[model samples]
Target: MLDFYTNPMSRGQTVRWMLEEVGADYQERLMNWGPSMKGTDYKKINPMGKVPAIVHEGRVVTECAAICAYLADAFPDAKLAPPPAARHDYYRWLFFAAGPLEQAVTAKSFGWTPTKEQSGVAGFGTYDLVVETMEGLLLSRAYVCGDAFTAADVYFGAQVLWGTRFGSLPSLHAFTDYAERLKGRPAYQKAKARDDALIAEGQAST
Candidate 1:
């Protein structure tokens, strides 16, 4: 069984959703933000002290996109990834979301808007460009790679869901429609319910 280390309120939710999608049985180890996460033991799993790390077969995987991709391939029966020949868009959009999209959203959250000249140097080019590009991508299809929902959607959808919720991304029709489709998934519902309960419990204890 896989061992999942996560916080209810972190990117861990993204991994949890992916796990549920693949129907993988995992043992969850909930960690708090400070001592529990920054402690030496947890640090061994992820030296960066980030949540949503996973240990399986004695190997550790960190980062949300990596974890989602790992789980999808690890459990091929779930068919979350497309075959090699047709995976161009799959890989493209996945890394795009992980790199440029994440950086743009995070930078915006901190009010660090890049100057037009600086945007040229930035990996994302510019925040508006990132948003518009993603919007165009989603506008073309139901899922990231097309009609078939792949592990790429798991990562991309989570970003859109979180981005829209936090007001980092606009609630355009494409984003909302895609998010609504993702929300309708049973796996998504289950993960959200589980995390919601955990969040409530943590709050009550605090």
Candidate 2:
């Protein structure tokens, strides 16, 4: 059985959506912030002391992007990944979203912009460039990996969804439309509802 360790409000939501997409049965071990997540016991699962780690078939997978990719490969019946022979764009944009795009978004959230000189080594170049590149990709196709939704979309779509909603990324038309399309997915809706309810329950008790 798949064992998922997460917090409702954390990036764990991304994995939850992927799990739902792949139709995998998982036992969620919700870990709150601070001690619950940082303690020695959980540390063995993820030394970084973060949420959204998974133990599947006795193998531990952390990092949202890796987990998404692993799930797609693990449960091939979901067709969440393109066949290995046709993964040019699939692998390309998946890493694009996980690496440069992710770095750019985090830089934006931290209110940091690398100078022109700094951009050379910053990896993401500039946030505007990263944003524009992503926008151009989505404007050309229905999904990141082209015509069909793949596990890559779960990670990429989550970026657009949370980034646009929280102001980390600009609300451009391409991003707006892309986020809407992802929101309509049953897996996305189901996973979101579960997290939303958890958030509400926590608030009520407080």
Candidate 3:
């Protein structure tokens, strides 16, 4: 069984959603921020002191996209990922969403506008470029890699959902339609509902 270390409100939600998608049997070890993550204990799992780390077969997997991709490949029966033949696009968009989209959206959200000189040196290039590129690609397909729903969609779809919700990306027909399509997935809804309930409980307790 996989050991999942997570916080209800962190990027761990991405892993949680992917675990549901792959239908993997997993154990959840919830960790609180600060002490639980910062102290000596959790640092043994992830030196970065981040949530959403998973232990599978005694190996630790960090990063939300990597964790999701790893599980999709590990559990071939789930069919969450494409076969080795279709790996090119599968790997392509997965990293694209993680590297470019994640950094771009985060920088933009925090009002960290970069100048042309700074953009060249930064990882995301520019927020406008990232948003336009994403809009162009998603507009051309029902999902990132194509029509089929793969683990890539789980990452890209979540980004779209976040971008749309936070007013970071344009609420174009492409984004809206893509979100509407993902809305019908039972796993997505189940994962989201579970996390939302936990978040509500945490808030009430505080």
Candidate 4:
């Protein structure tokens, strides 16, 4: 069985949506922020003490993108990923969305502006480049890799949702259109509804 450790409010939701997409039989261990994660036992599972870690096939995988990729490979029957022949774009867009886009948006959200010289040397390029690159790819097709939906979409779509939520990325017509399309998916709807309800409950208790 696949073991997934996560907090519903975090990036862990991305992996949860992927698991739902893959229709994998798995178990979820929810870690609520403070005490559960700080314990030594949890640290052994994920030293970073981050949510969205997974243990599968005797290997522990951390990070949302990595877990998504690993699940695609682990459950070949789900066909959540492209075949080996079509893997170039698959890996390219996956890591691209995971790294540059996520980093750049997060930095912008926090109001951090790197120096001109520093920006050129940084890993995420510039904010404009990040937005333009994503806009170009998304404006071209319904999904990232042409017509079919893949695991890359899971990561990319999540990043887009988060970026838009935090007001980091532009809420362009194309982005709004795409997000609507993604939300139409049953898995996305299910995961989001559950998380929303959980948040509501937490707020009520407090």
Alpha-carbon local distance difference test for all models: 0.94, 0.95, 0.87, 0.86
- Kindly list the per-residue Cα lDDT of model 1 for residues 134-195, writing each as its tens digit: 99999999999899999999999999999888898999999999999999999999999999
Task: Give Cα distance to truth, residue 202, candidate 3, Å.
Answer: 0.6
Model 2 worst lDDT run, 10 consecutive residues:
138-147
Q: Provide C-alpha RMSD values for all models, in order.
A: 0.7, 0.8, 1.3, 1.3
> TM-score of model 2 relative to the true fold?
0.98
Task: After the best TM-score superposition of candidate 3, give how far the Cα of residue 121 lies from its true spot, in angstroms.
Answer: 3.5
Question: Judged by lDDT relative to the true structure, which candidate is superior, 3 or 4?
Answer: 3
lDDT (10s digit) by residue, model 3, range 1-206: 79999988888888888888888888989898879988898899999999989999999999988998998989888888987888788888899999988898889878998999999998889998987888788778888878889998888888888778778777988898998898788888888888888899999999
The whole-model C-alpha lDDT of candidate 3 against the native structure comes to: 0.87
User: Which residue pairs show collisions in model 3?
Assistant: none
**Candidate 4, number of clashes:** 0
Clashing residue pairs, backbone N/CA/C < 3 A, model 4: none
Candidate 4, residue 29: the lDDT equals 89
The CA-based lDDT of model 4 is what?
A: 0.86
